[model samples]
Target: MGAAESTGTEREPLLGPSQAEATVQPVTNSGRVYGRRWLVLTLFSMLAFLQGMVWNTWGPIQNSAKQAFGFSSTDIAILVIWGPVGFIPWLLFMWLMDKKGLRASLLLTVFFMVLGSALRSVPLTNLQLRRWLIHGGQLLNGLAGPTLMSAGPLLSTTWFAPDQRATATAVASLVGYLGAACSFLIGPLAVPAPNDTQIVNSNIHWDTEQIRNRIQFVLYAELGMIAVLFAVVLLYFPSRPPVPPSVAAASQRLSYRSSICRLLSNMRFLMIALAYSVPTGVLAGWSGVLDMILTPVRVSQVDAGWIGFWSIVGGCVFGVAMARFADYIRGMLKLIAVLMLAGASLAATWFTLTCLTRLTHLPSTKATLYTSCILLGIFINSSIPIFFELFIETVYPVPEGITCGVVTFLSNLFTGLLLFFLTFYITAKDRDGKKQDNAALTRGLAKQM
Candidate 1:
């Protein structure tokens, strides 16, 4: 719960010039074995994937979730925001990791995720009660978010050789993104498509029975997956290997507060963190509202889901390649991050304007939207692993988990603020327009979809 300070007298060397070089450079021969680190990476990566699965579950199915519970766009948006809102828990859990080590923190994460999944799936007739239960479930799962997000870099540092850390982290990150992509594909696949006539009549709004049935099907599958993973993690995963896999990981860890202070004082770290915060927050917030943004364009939920699917696919392919290249080159991390962010920003801006202008019917415009989504995914998501690796590189000797936790916490705060305003602004605008053309828009919207 509380962090203990490492006094100067008791503290290990703060990873100065000599120590930094020794830890970060490759020491092992090309043929050297990596021991059980690979197995550990696999286990943590599964956790990352499962966390991704639950985090975006409602997003791909946002429309169904909204209809099933009769929630407004604003109300459903709150569910997505809960994950970032768990920033407080993020700090506590990261501290837990630093104080208690990986196994305790990881077990804690699994417990919250499983318990949350079970609670969320509780079938109840009272709509409001069911909504609250699901909200509560989401908040619990949110507590696990920081742990999973930060764990890849930390795990890589702990369990990989210097040359292997970037690729290992990239692979772990890839699976998590893969889990998210599957959610987009899986959410709609689990729910039968609305009848053509029903879609034309009511804008793809399924009957409550249909919505509930689809949601139940997905929830049960999610629960089953969680149960299996829980067993796997508990049985085979260790707190750590008896031996340290890398010199960097074997180095002394700074106290939590001290690490925070160090990062705060570092101008390069602060600058990069600020720049990195924007795309990460924007992309995540935009993902949550994708269905709503596409509503006026009449993009069917299935089509919108496919857009997400392809976007994440792009992220996986490019993300791994970029990370591995960074590992090989071992420089230009900042320049690479900047170029990726620039590309993503351009793609995102182009897509935003097209969607807002209601240009979906234009063949060229639709193609543009899909292309931009994938490009945005590739650029933004690929940059994530690079920026994280750069963060550790810049602030050597600071434990990967703590620095990553700090970065995630701050970026998520920005994300929450962006979502808060975006939700209100869009919701208010939509509400006002609906008041004037309620009947005509309803019919037209249905036909458009």
Candidate 2:
């Protein structure tokens, strides 16, 4: 279908006189009432939580997977690529969602998630087969990624008034972080304890196999729950709200391309996207290697799990708070750009400090590391809500499903591809350096002996 034709549908009323009046309603002594919209927001948040949970499940267990599969950092990097690889197909899905409807798109997302999760959970006899299946599952997961990403912002735009849009979007963004937090906090419990002989120095222990099984089980359970949510969504998610006859025709004739172009062409959008790109890449890469990063710092696997958890916590807190503030000020785009810049700065600082501390072998910097982590979480994640809010406010009265899909598709696609190349280069350099260092050390020791 043509873009314009695809976007054309029975239009819902953008705003009634009463609703329009309420848009500028003064804060009474009782304060603003967010009644049913809260319910809609809550559901969208749950969707975010589920998406985050699924995506993050791999990070805390990366070390365990490496040991179990005899995989190098490069191999693990490939695994990381699998997650965002799904972003490529998301554009088509977005188009389809726009052409079809929200319910159709949501159903498709659930299907992909279910299929991917089920595939990932299946045991394979050979290592190659397992890798193939896992990566395939990741691709399927990516298919659903855009749907969930779009759904939250779309819901926010449709259900919320202008003043509430930022806060609603922010709360939606927080849900995913909350999901990530839950995964990290629960990962340790899911894995079985190592045998006594496996313990090193009475503190360190590793159980690679058990961790994999635990992860598989979690994915299976998540898939089941997602299937349930799909049913609920199919039944309950509205296509459009009731509209007055006079304005309905105008709303129905709105063009998806016009809305998308408006958002994509905005200078503010580009700035926010660029500013967020680096930090998003860093976070994505860091999460994939989180276990390895924490190992040398005396953080055990169990303790390291808390890193993702706390990062999510920080993200959730900041996402909600900043979103609400932005809503109040109608500064969603500005807030997003500021948050992205702040996140990038914090990440760079943390990276520098981490390198220095490691090279100098300075006194344990646990507190410093922890502080950096919290800041990283808050700053890095705050952009999500802000971006969502900006998208909704800027693309007013447009078919939300299509607009959301396009924005998410572009953002994820760019960010994902950028990280893929960055990951390859960084891992390759680190590997070469390690190999050279080992060889030099060996030669020096032999000469001394």
Candidate 3:
């Protein structure tokens, strides 16, 4: 499928593939596309899936994680926020990819992926110790975030032809999202939310024998899967295809610094980046804390899990279809992007209104809540591939890895800030409530006097 040529109106100077590539035994320099590229894509997509699964392990199971580990909402937010924090060294990893190639960068990914799960799977009775170990594991996993999140365009460009790049990128990118979707179900099913919280040091800490055991089981399961993936990738995956798939696949790229400068200066690309980041970031942040947000509305953790799972799954279904549509008619990129963004905006507003617990006049039904969430997922998640393809088209001759990397970075940054701000707001609300309680008690004492 990738061997077919892309039909479009474009002009370009053809400079062939790079010179400094690993030319292994039993391979030729012919630029013919190969079927094995799909296999490579499948493997890379698995990495995407597992890494994303690891990242979201704590979010959807908010009550479960809290009940099992005695975690605060702030703690939960901090755990889920690690992915963005991991991107601090993203440029260093990008440098590794550019110099050491895709294979080395992916190795770093699998290493962190498995290692993080391993740490989380450790059995420890002391709550502080167990929580710290889990934090360590999450931090290690965070180190893998940039590659797992940003490498979609790079992987697709490396293996697939031009005509299939958009769809390929969509699959590679959204598969991680699918893993995230599955996480919503897996946590809820594996570990049922317990009815009681264990009190420790005069504070309410959610923990029970059953809940803790189930949480450990979930961690162990993830570790086992990641270990298998690591072994498979190490044994078989290659850095690049034996032959280039297309002109873009084979073509040399601009320097990393030069590409960043060009992207930074380009107004069109910046607008696209901004458009892509906001809703995407908010939805992601919102989803990560879905249980927390919906708790005030009386939604159970299990129900929130289902909502996240189906919403993302539905979005992925719509996203893949839209990606194919994007491929079929490249000219309609702008219109399609506009329509999806508009739909996403309305869906987000609708979901917000439906979730408002304090608004006495708003219609806050579970039915409307679910519908709005699903619609948000479809419209927001579907735009990812479109934006990726658009970025590459807008900044031709720049490497796909760099462009998508920066794009993903912006989205993660927005997500991180939103998570932090929301957490802070919640914490401050608790403090204010405590202060008012103390003031009321003081007034009662004065009246007795």
Candidate 3, residue 414: the lDDT equals 92
> What Cα-based lDDT does every candidate model obtain?
0.76, 0.62, 0.80
On TM-score, who's better, 1 or 2? 1
Better of 1 and 3 by TM-score: 3
1-449: candidate 1 lDDT, tens digit per residue: 00111233222322343432342332333212246677778788787787777878887777777667777778767877887887777768888989898888888888888998998999999999998888898888888888888778887766665666788878875677777788888987787544531356565455779878889888888888887888887887776644454444566778999988898999998888887777777777777667666666777778778888889878888888988887777567878988998898799877777766645443435677788888998898888888888888788778888888888888788878877987788689878878878888888999999
Q: Top model by TM-score, which number?
A: 3
What residue runs in model 3 are displaced by over 4 Å at the alpha carbon? 1-31, 196-207, 357-360, 437-449
lDDT of 1 at 334: 75
lDDT per residue (tens digit) for residues 1-449 in model 3: 22234433112313334553333222223234557778788988988888878888888777877767889888888888887788888888877877788888998889988888888888988889989989989889988888877888888888765666778889999998898889898988887775531122335333477777888888888899889989988898888875655566766789989988999999999999999988787777778888788777777777888888888888888888998877767577778889999998898788777766478468788788889888989998998888888888888778878888888888988989999899899889879988999999999999999
User: Which candidate leads in lDDT?
Assistant: 3
Query: What total of clashing residue pairs does each candidate reach?
Result: 0, 0, 0
Tens digits of per-residue lDDT, candidate 2, 19-114, equal 534433322321223345565566556766776677766666666665655556666666666656777776577677667765677677777877
Q: Weakest 10 consecutive residues, lDDT, candidate 2?
A: 1-10
Model 2's lDDT to the true fold?
Answer: 0.62
lDDT of 2 at 169: 62
Ranking by TM-score: 3, 1, 2
Q: How does each model score on TM-score?
A: 0.86, 0.78, 0.89
Candidate 1 clashes: the total is: 0
